[model samples]
Target chain A: MISIDWYLALSAILFCIGIVGVLIRKNAIVIFMCVELMLNAVNLSLVSFSSHYGNVDGQILVFFSLAIAAAEAVVGLAIIIAIFRNNFSVDITQINLLRW
Target chain B: MITYSFIFLAVLAVATALGLVISKNTVNSALFLVLNMVSLSGVYLLLQAQFLAIIQILVYAGAIMVLFLFVIMLLNIDEEESLFNKFRIKYFVAFLLGVGIFAQLIYSIGSFSDTLPVVSAQMAEAGTVEAIGDVLYTKYSLPFHIIAMLLTAAVNGALLVAQHKTKPLTEEND
Candidate 1:
């Protein structure tokens, strides 16, 4: 039988990678993708824990999280589009109007 | 059999995520994210979360990624110049933060000595659609309805944000 720790470890690794990507990537879209990666990693661990406990609650939570992720993606990408429209660039370094 | 499949899917997921980060082109990054999502669905299947696996594929790989690709193509964004050109200090700090968090997580996992319960037939049944549906409708019904409203709001918000504001004729004349 596979140990639950292994799944948890994988989740941690993926989550860290997502964090690194978000911090290092310059493009807003790529940063958004990294955020999705982080969400997926969380979902993986949630499902694993659900299976481990033999409870359906964790899976149900994953369902709601997935829905929320979809909603976030929609609004986030639209914001990215709006930013692109005004600035004509999606590079984070260049879109520093808010930076004092 | 399941162990080997789990390893493969886990490796694939990690590799694709790295690819998404490394790829300079926005479209390529989006494609890598698609691959990553697909591989994660496979992992979900191995974990016996059948419904979640399907939703991961449909909602993440299918819907969200399509929107990403559409925006990437529509915008025609230029490839990023380089990953670490201007932000050496930032990249180094980010790497250190990643390593620190990873070390903490691994330490926690290592210290956890309790053996997880073995998967049984009952556990398998817990992942089924009927089981989840029962719990979701009864215990989580309020959240479900809230999610419906959230989706509706998100759609309207997206439309409002993405809508191009046309200048009045007077402004154009000026």
Candidate 2:
């Protein structure tokens, strides 16, 4: 039987990669993809724990997370598209009008 | 067999994730993210979340990714260059932080073992659609309805925000 620690480790590594990508990547969309990666990592952990405990709560929670993720994607992409229309670029470094 | 499958899926997930982050072209990155999502769904299957596995593929790989692709193509943004130029201090800091976080997590969780009671066979059935539906509709019905409302609002909000320039304000002023 695969251990829970294995899953946990994998999730942790994936989450850190997402964080790194968020920090290093310049494209707004790629940053957004990294955020999705972080969410997926959390979902993996949640499922692993749910299975470990033999409870349905974790899976149900996953359902809610997935729903929220989808909603977030729509709003986020709309914002990105809006920004692209005005700025003509999705590079975070370039779209710094709000930077103080 | 499960361990082997886990290793395979995990490697695929991590590889595609890295590719998504590093690929220069946005379209290529998007495709890599799709591969990552599919591999994650496979991992979900290994975890016995049959329903979730299917939903992951449908919602994430299908709907969400299509939305990403549409915006990506619609924007027609070009590839960014010199992403790894002169070693900025921030990049170093970010890498350090990532490594620190990973080390901390691994150190903390290394000794931990599963203590939860093994799921009873019947309770394990809860991973199925029918079982989840029973709980979702009964105990979590209010939140479910709320999520439905939220989705509708998101759709309307996206439409409003993304609508093309409706005859510039200057035309109205004239």
Clashing pairs in 2: none
Tens digits of per-residue lDDT, candidate 2, B1-174, equal 888999999999899889888888889889988998899899888777889999999999999999999888888864667553244886998899999999998888777775653333544587889989999999999999999999999998888787777634554553
Listed per prediction, chain B TM-scores read: 0.89, 0.86
Worst lDDT 10-window in candidate 1 chain A: A91-100
Local accuracy of candidate 1 as per-residue lDDT tens digits, A1-100 = 6788888898999999999999999899999999999999999889888887888888998999989999999999999999999898888888777865
Model 1 residue B116 lDDT score:
60
Best model per lDDT: 1
Candidate 1's residue-wise lDDT over B7-106, tens digit each?
8988998999899888878889899999988988988888888999999999999999998999898999847677632788998999999999999988
Per-residue lDDT, model 2, residue A94, is: 79
What TM-score quantifies how close candidate 1 is to the native fold?
0.94
Q: Write the per-residue lDDT of candidate 2 for residues A6-95, one digit (tens) a residue.
A: 888988988998998898888899899999999999998888878777788998999999999999999999889888888888888776
Q: For model 1, name the residue pairs that clash.
A: none
lDDT at B119, model 2? 35
